[model samples]
Target: MTDSQRTALIDHDVWNGGLFGGADGRWYAADQTRDVIEPATGERLTNIGVARAADVARAAKAAAAAQPAWAALAPRERAAVLRRAAAALERNLEDAARYIARETGGILAKAQLEVAEAATQLHIAAALPLQPQGLLLPSTAGRTSYARRVAHGVVGVISPFNFPLILSMRSVAPALAMGNAVVLKPDPQTPVSGGFLIARAFEEAGLPPGVLQVVPGDADAGAAVVEAPEVRMIAFTGSTAAGRKVGELAGRLLKKVSLELGGKNTLIVLEDADLDVAASNAAFGAFFHQGQICMATGRIVAHRKIAAELTRRLIDKAQTLPVGDPASGTVAIGPLINERQLRGVDAIVRASIEAGAVLEAGGTFERLFYKPTVLSNVQPGMRAFDEEIFGPVAVITPFDSDDEAVELANRTEYGLACAVIGASVARASAIGERLKCGLLHINGQTIADECVNPFGGRGDSGNGGSMGGPADPDEYTQWQWVTVKSTAERTPF
Candidate 1:
C-alpha cells in the first residue's frame, strides 16, 4: 500500500492484504470494514477489515493446531525469536510511535514511550523461558516425581485503545515465550498500532505461521475469543464493566483469565510537602495522556493547611498545558479517543459542578480537545470524586487529618493505584500502607510501571490476577505432575 493510502500514518508496505491475519499465513478478507478515524483531526485515516465471531474462531483453531510444535522447540530457540522481535520493534520505533500518536491522539512522547515499553516487554519475556519452570517432589523408592509448567495451548488477548502497544504486547510476548500460540483481538479504534504492528514484528523475526494471529473487531469478536473452545486462557485490559463480563464468561467456560481493569487512583499531598513538587506531580498524574490512563489520578487528597495554595498552583499548571493535535509534537494534552468519551468526561465535570464542586481552571473543549480542568472542594459523594473520569480533569479534596486522608482515598470501590507525597518517605509509606490499592507510590505519582513488577489491581479493578514479572509463568501455563518408576510394581489386580 502507498503512504497516501494509509493517510501517511506510517511508511510500511505490509498491509497490502486484509487487516485480519488468519491462520493460513494470509490476511483474510472480511465482508465488513471499519473506518479508522484520527481522533485529533476527525478524519478517516484508513479502513480495515472487521472480524466477526466466525473469524475469531478460525484464528483460535489455527493457534491450537500450531501450539504443540512451537512448544516442542528448545527454550533458547524461543528466546532468540523473542529477542529478534524486540530488535525489529526498536528498528522501526519512530514510525511506530508516529502511527500510535496519529491513531490514538496521544502526544508523540507518550507514544514513543509506549513503543519503547513494548520492546522492553519483549526483552523481558525473552528471559522467561530460561528461568526455572518446575519443582522436584518427594517420591517413594524406585520412583521419581516432579511438577512442571506446561503451555495452555492457546491464549486470547483483548487490548484497549489507550496505551495499545504496551498493553497488548505485555500479554502477547510472554504467552509466546512460554510456548503458547496467541490470537489477539485489539480494539477496533487502534487496529494498526495495537495489532498489525505486533504481527509485522513477529513475522519479520521469522515466527512460524499460525503461532500468532491478529484479529481486530468490536464486542462480538471479543465474545467469540472468550467462547472459542480451542482457547484455554484470556488476558483482557479494559473497563471494569467490560472486564466483569469477560471474567464471568471465561469462568463459566473454565478458562484461565487475567483481567487488568479500571481504576479511580488517588494522589495524597501532605502538609509538609513542597508545594512546587506536589503541584508538578499532580499535573503529570492527572493530565498525562489527557488523563486516559487507568492509573491516572482520579482524585487528589491534600492536607487542609496547604490545600488552597496547592490548588492555586495546580490551576496555574492546568492553564498552561497546551491542548491540540498530538501529531504536531508540541501539545502536552491531546484529544480524547472519540466523541463518546468526550461526552462522558464533560458530563462528569458538569455534574460535579452542580454538586457544589468549584471549577477553578477549565470546563471547556474545542472539538475533541478537552482542556486540562481543575475542580476544588470535591467530596467523597460527588461524581467527580466517585466516578472514573478518564479525561484531563483533576479534582482536589481537602482532609483534616491523616486518618481522614486514608478514608477519603479508600472511599471508592475501585483500588488500582495510589500515591503519597510527603517531606519524609517513611512517613508517606506508612500512610500509603493504610490505603487499599494494588500499586502504591511514595514521593511520586500514581502512573508508574516497570517490566519487572507485577501489575494489576483489587476490588472492582481486577480479580487478583496480575501480569509481568513473576506472574507470567502462572498466568500463561498450567501445572502438570509427572511420576516414573525404575521398576515395575507388583499388580494388586
Candidate 2:
C-alpha cells in the first residue's frame, strides 16, 4: 500500500456515510455517523453510518419477509448462489485485502490470508446444500423417519474487528447457504472490510434482495440486533464480556446463540521436543497479526530440560520480527486495532514485569505499534500468564514434569485452543487429549484453521457452539424430525 493507494482507500466515498440493507437493495445515509480512524497512522479513514434501533428492526423485518422464499429454493440453487459469491470474493481479493489491512492495521500478509480464508469459507459453505445424506437417517420397521434441517428465519451476525473478514464469513456464509437471511452488525472500527466487502460480494453474485443486511455501529447497534424480535439466532465473535451479554439476552428470548470469545491459550513444549521447531511455532502463534487472534498463544509451558534453550531461541525470534507499517513487505507485527488496546497491552506488560516476570525483549511501543515482546519467568499469578494478552507478547514458563505442564496449561479460565509440541506424535496427541481447550494442535502452531474443521472454544471462551466444517449449519438452523406411518398402524397422532 503506497501513499497514493492509502489516500484513495482513506478517501473512498462509497462507504463514507452509508448503511447497507439488502432488504432495500441499496445503501442509505444514516441520521448519524461515526468516523473510522486508521490505527497505524492515526488518520481518518472514513465516516460510517450508525444504525439505530429502528434500523435494526427494519433489517430484521426485511430478513424475515425474504427468508421463506429463499428457503423454498432448491438446495442446489442455493449452493450455486454461494459458489458465485465465492467467485466474486476471489475476483475482489486484492482490493479487499488492501481494505482489510488499512482498516484493521493487520499486516498485508495477514489481510491476504483473511481474504483467502473467507473465500474458502464461502466455497465450503456451498457444499452444505449439495450433501445428499446430511439430513437423512435410518427408519424403523413401520415408518420412515428423518430429520430436515431448516433455517432459524433470521440470523444476526456480530463480528469483531480482528479477523473481521473470516470471522464474519464463519457465520454469514453458513447462514446464507442454509437459507437464512442475515442482519450483520460488524465492529464499528471495521465496517468496510467486515460488513461492506461481504455484502458487496454476495450482492454482485446476485443474492436476492433482503437476504443480507449490513448495519454498522458500536455496542448499541449490536444490542439492537440481539434484542430484535425477528432474529431467531445470533452468531457472535468478540470478548467474553460482550459475548456474555449477547448470550444472556438471547437466552431470555429463547433465541439460538453461538459465541466464539476470548482465550488464554497455551503452547507446550515437552522435554524431547525440537527447540527450533517449538520456538518457531511459538513466534508465529504469539506474534502473527500482532497477536490479535483469539487463540494466540498466551502462555508457553516448556519442559525444564529444554526451557533455557527454547526461551533463548524465542527471545531471539521476537527481537528479529519486523514491527512497523503493515503495508510494508514481510512484516510480522503491525499496529493494534486502536490506542486503547495498545495501552492495555502496554499496561499488562508493565504490570507483569513488576509482578516478577522477566521482560526478555521488545517491550517498547510507538502509537498503536507494540514490539513483538518476549517474557520469561512468568508465574501463575502474573497477568501475562493468566489473562489473554491479545498482543504480540509471548510468555515462557518452565515446568518440571508433563503433569505440571498440563496443570499449568489448564489453570486459566479460558479453554479456547492450545498446542503441544514434542518429538513423538503419539505422546503429544495423548497429552493434547488431557488439555482442556476445544481445539488443539500437536507439533505445530495453534494459529492454523480450516473451513472443513470445526472451530470454536470451551468454558469462558464460548458456549460450545462451533463454526465451520459439516457442523457449521448447526449454529444457524434447527432440526425437525419428520416421520411417515405405514398404512395407519404406526400413526401416533
Candidate 3:
C-alpha cells in the first residue's frame, strides 16, 4: 500500500454503529454526524459524528448518572481499571500512533513517540488512586481533623488538535483515576487518534460505561460538553482566544477550570553558548510536529556575535528535513492539521515579512505543507515575535548583551517555557531564574518533559488556579485545611 493509504482513517463502531454515546461499554451511535477528512490530501477518510447538544446532553447525563457508582468503587479498583486501560493503550499503540500521524499531520517517528509516551502518561496518572491521602491536622490531640481527596464528579476535558493523544491524557486520565467520569471533547482534527482510540482502549480494558466518553468534534460540540450544568469542572488545552471564552463561560457557570493555553515562548542563545547545541535545540523546538505546539519556541534571542552562524546552521539543518506522507516511516515533518492552521501559518509569515522581519529560510506554504521557516533581523516588538505562531516559523532576534537577551526572552505575555543556552551552567541558570516562564531549561528548548514538572504555562498562556507547582493532576482536585482546638469542652462565649 502507498504511504498515503497507510494513514487512512479506519472505520469504527463509533460511527458505523450509530454510536452517539457509550454507557456500560455499549455504544449507542444514534447522533448527527459528519466526515473525517485527511488534512494532508484533502481526502474524506471516513464518516464521524458531529454530536449535537442533545446527543452531548445524553452522554453527559449518562456519565453523571453513573459517576456515583464508579466513585463508590474501591480506589484500588479504579486504579486497576486505569492500569487496564494503560495496558490496552500499549497493546494498540501502533494502531493509535499511525492514526495520530495521519489525523494530526505529525511525522511517523514523532507520532510513534507521542503515542508511546502518552501511554506512559496515562499509566502514570492511573497510579493516582494509590496516592490519594487524608492529611491530618496537628491541632488539638484526639480531635479528628483530616481532609479527604475526592473526585469532583463529572469532569469535562477539551483538548486541542495538535498532540492529541498526549494532551488528552494530560487531563482525562487523571480525572478517571481519581474516580471522576470524563466527557472528552477531543479536537476534530484528531478524532481517530485521540478520541476514538481512547474510547476503544477503555472499552477493551473493561472500563465501566459512562466513566469515559470520547466525543469527536469542533468548538460547538465542545460547547455542548461545557454548557452541561452537571459538569463539575473543565480542563482545557488550546488557543488563548478560545481559552478565554471557555474561562468566561466556566466562570459564569461557577465551574472550576484548568487551562493550558497558547504561547510565544522564546529561546535565548548567549554568546558563551555552544552554537551547535543552540541550532539543534531551536530546530527541534520549532520543527517538531511542524511547530503546532502551544509551547513551541516561537522566538529566539541569539547573541549577535553568533546570530548569523546559528541562523545558517539552523537553515541547513531544516533544509534537509523530510516532508510528506506522515505515516511513512522516514518522513521528518508533516503538513499542517488543516486549512485553518495552514492559513494561520501563512498569515503569520506574511505579517512578519510586512513588519520588516527578514525571512532566513522556509517561508513557503505549498498546499498544506508549510516549509520550516527561519526569520532573521526580527524585532522583539513584531507580532511574529510576540504572537503564538502555531507553525514552523522560527523568528530569530539578535541581542548584544546577556541582560538584553533575558529582557527579550521575557518580553512576551506568555510565561509558558523558555531556555538559556550558555557556556556556564551557573550563568545559564542565573539567566533562567530571571526569566518569567513557568519552565526554564538550560542549554535546551522549551518542550513538554512529561515526568519532570508541571507541563502547563502561565499568564495568558495558562489558566487560573493555585496549582503552580509540579504536583500530579489528582493533587489539584484535592482540598486541605486544618482546624486547631482543644479536645476538652470550651466555655460558651
**Which candidate number would show the highest lDDT if scored against the true structure?**
1
Cα deviation in Å at residue 90, candidate 1?
0.4
Per-candidate RMSD vs. true structure? Answer: 2.8, 3.7, 4.2
Cα lDDT, model 1, residue 351: 96
TM-score for each candidate, following the candidate numbering: 0.97, 0.94, 0.92
Candidate lDDT scores, in order, read 0.91, 0.86, 0.77
- State which candidate has the highest TM-score: 1
Superior candidate under lDDT, 2 versus 3: 2
Candidate 1: clashing pairs of residues: none
Count of backbone collisions within predicted model 2? 1
Give the candidate order by descending TM-score. 1, 2, 3
Model 2 lDDT per residue over 285-323, tens place: 999889999989999899988888998998888888777
In candidate 1, residue 192 scores what lDDT?
A: 89
